[model samples]
Target: MAALQIRQDYSAPDLRQRAARERDTRASLRLLAIANALEGMPRAEAAGLAGIKCQALHDAIQRFNAEGPDGLHDRHRSGRPEQLSPGQQAALKAHILHGPEPERDGVSAWHLVDLCEYVERTYGDSEWGLSGPLKRLNLSRQKTRPSHSNGHPAAQAAFKKGAAVTAAEPRGTAS
Candidate 1:
């Protein structure tokens, strides 16, 4: 069987320059390295210099031959689709930003679990997890103790005075 060879080949220096300039991805560089090697060396040696398997080099060479530099790019992978659409995500963000109504939202503040449940009920995508949806909505967990409408300023001052006294007291039989 004949070894695969690069066609419409650029010179080694040209390939190097093109590889670096065409795209900045690792895949592109690797492809360019293989192409560069094939310019002056054999297929197996080219693959070795590129640190890829011969089969991979062959495939890349085929792609390069067919589509030039563009074929060397990483192909798009069909990842999991968004559980919520753009409008739905916007609505969710607004819902969070508007703040949860204690009586209406059934909770004082947003909890991830509660948010997940809300998403399930509101958007019908129960698969929505904490991090992904929160990131998508540009939301983060804010740690804040709820302030009471009738919080006692006097009591707080008294507590601070007592704390200062305690802190000032000599420890372990002074001097």
Candidate 2:
């Protein structure tokens, strides 16, 4: 909407500096749109240039002309930008990989929380403020083998098949 045609007709962004800024921009745009209309520019041309359709532009112009300068706001620029940027998480993985180990001793397995804290500490300690988008690690802990364990992939597969299939058929159904 143009810079001036603001109203109390509908809900609006909060009435602080940001809201006031929105009003000014809207009021200014409203003025410009009306000026353009008055100068005989076509509605489509003016509206498109103002980043809205002619109908929207006309509506904005009407609202401003009737009211004052509070209507031009694009609300909710807060709260994590209010939308997701996909694959932003990749950057975090790269950063986490680059940072120092969280544990002084490299002997122990890493807990998930330890990794997270490590990320915060290592990067946050440095200048960049150390944040990146988050994602699950591609790898996971392999199931620990029992004390009497067989270390074969095929054995594992057979075990799974047996476990899965045994429940379905009773003890003597093969005949």
> Which ten contiguous residues of candidate 2 have the minimum total lDDT?
125-134
- Candidate 2 to truth, TM: 0.30
Deviation in angstroms for 144 in model 2? Answer: 9.7
Cα lDDT of model 2 by residue, 48-97, tens digit: 65556676776766665565445443445555431223343455456445
TM-score of each: 0.65, 0.30
Best by lDDT: 1
Candidate 1 clashes between residue pairs 3 or more apart in a chain or in different chains: none
lDDT of 2: 0.49
